[model samples]
Target: MKTIAINGSPRKGWNTHILVEEALKGAASKGSDTELVNLYDLNFKGCISCFECKRRGGKSFGRCAAGDDLKPVLDRIHTCDALIIGSPIYISEVTAAVRALFERLTFQYITYSKDRKTFFTRRVPTALIYTMNISEPAIESMGYAEKFKFYEDRFNQIIGPAKTLVSTETWQTTDYSKYEMTMFDGEARKKRREEIFPQDKRKAFELGAGLV
Candidate 1:
């Protein structure tokens, strides 16, 4: 089975990367072939809103028309059995790179039938991992959690139910001297790392192992 993980964090080895790596490790333990793509390392542009992909009688139907880094990645996403995406929240939404990837990838799958209605028909099982500095309560208060739900529903409607993994109230601004105090929530994070996350990771691994 094949699984593809997309790391959307600009920081290569930071929180988002750690979570994706752990999930991938679990997947590998189940004897699934896994690959990771770091978006910041690739050269890609945001979707240009060109109607070329949806043009009638066009050869690029069901594919992105723009020639950019997203083309190859989209190819993998289309064929991969399981997809894992990790991103650090910027403001109340995902990072720009991830958002751009979504825009470009989603456009490729947009289609219409004889009725002239648009819809997404291609199905891909997916998981979304988002880490942020805001606490869960704060996220709800700020309406970010609801925004996440919007994305979740959209993904489920377009691709499939995307298992959501969120790490909130993370330590982003760290100082060496008062590190212990700053990591007051370290124990909780550790528990999640050692327990909750591993379970999901194993599940993801099994999902990959069972894929065709």
Candidate 2:
């Protein structure tokens, strides 16, 4: 089996990347060859409303016609057994790169007919991971949980059975004093990173293995 993990965060060694890597490791341990993709490394845009994928009898029907770096990634996902996507919360939403990938990946398979919902041939297990500076208790109050549910519901309907893993109060920087972010205590963040992040990683690993 092949499982593909996509990292939506720009920072390679940060929380989102680390968790995605851990998930891949878990899939690897299950004897599934896995790949990790960094969305920032590619140059692409969100769906341009070309509607070529929806065209009947068209050569590019049921596929994204946009030619760019994201094309190959979408091609790989079409054949993968499982998928894992991780991103850091930016402005209370996923990063722009992740959003672009999401649109291109999901919109292609979507159909307008009432007879069929998607053109995808098979169901692929999926996971969504999110890391944020806010505490766990704040997720609902901040409407993040509602947003996450919306994404998960879409993935479930269009892709496959989906689950989510969240890491809260993420450590943003080694030296927070360098930035003007005075709202957070750097030491407390460091303590939580040391104490809680490992547990998060373990959960990510299990989540991946379960996908297999």
Candidate 3:
């Protein structure tokens, strides 16, 4: 078995990265070859509407054709068993990297012809992890969860339903005192980091193993 994780967070060791790493560990423990991809390290763009993937029986049919650093990744994805994508919410939506990756990954595989078939005939277990500055209660209040769920449903429609990991009210910096950020209660955020984050990692590990 092979499982790969892509993290769209710019920070190397931040919340989203940590969660994805945890999940990868789980997949590895289950005897799967696991890899962690940091999207920031890659240079790529979203689908350019080339429609090359729409060409019937062509080399690009039912696959991404964007030629860049992400192409090799897509090639691997075509044969991989499990996929995990995680990102920090930027203004209530996925980061540019994750959004671009999604556009390329999903649009290419989506066949618009009659029957609306997806490229993947077999269900590929997947995971979606999110890191945000908001709290759990505020997520539904802001309707952000629905937006995330829409993409989850999109993933399911293409491949399969994804297990999700959410880290909320994240600590943005090592020292909150350095910045002029009075909106958040530092103590509560620290409490979450100390108490809840460990459990979240454990959950991520379990999610990964289950996917395998």
Question: Model 3 over residues 65-90: C-alpha lDDT tens digits?
Answer: 77899999988887899999999999
Candidate ranking (lDDT, best to worst): 2, 3, 1
Give the per-residue lDDT digits (tens) of candidate 1, residues 52-96: 778878887667888787788988887777778889998778999
| Candidate 2 lDDT over residue span 61-135, tens digit each | 999989999999999999999999999999989999999988999999999898867989799999999999898
TM-score of 3: 0.96
Off by over 4 Å in 2: none
Evaluated at residue 118, the lDDT of candidate 1 is: 41
> How far in Å is the alpha carbon of 170 misplaced in model 3?
1.2
The C-alpha TM-scores of every prediction are 0.80, 0.98, 0.96
Specify the highest-lDDT model's number. 2
The C-alpha lDDT values of all candidates are: 0.74, 0.95, 0.88
**Which window of ten consecutive residues has the lowest lDDT sum in model 1?**
203-212
Candidate 3 displacement at residue 146 in angstroms: 1.0
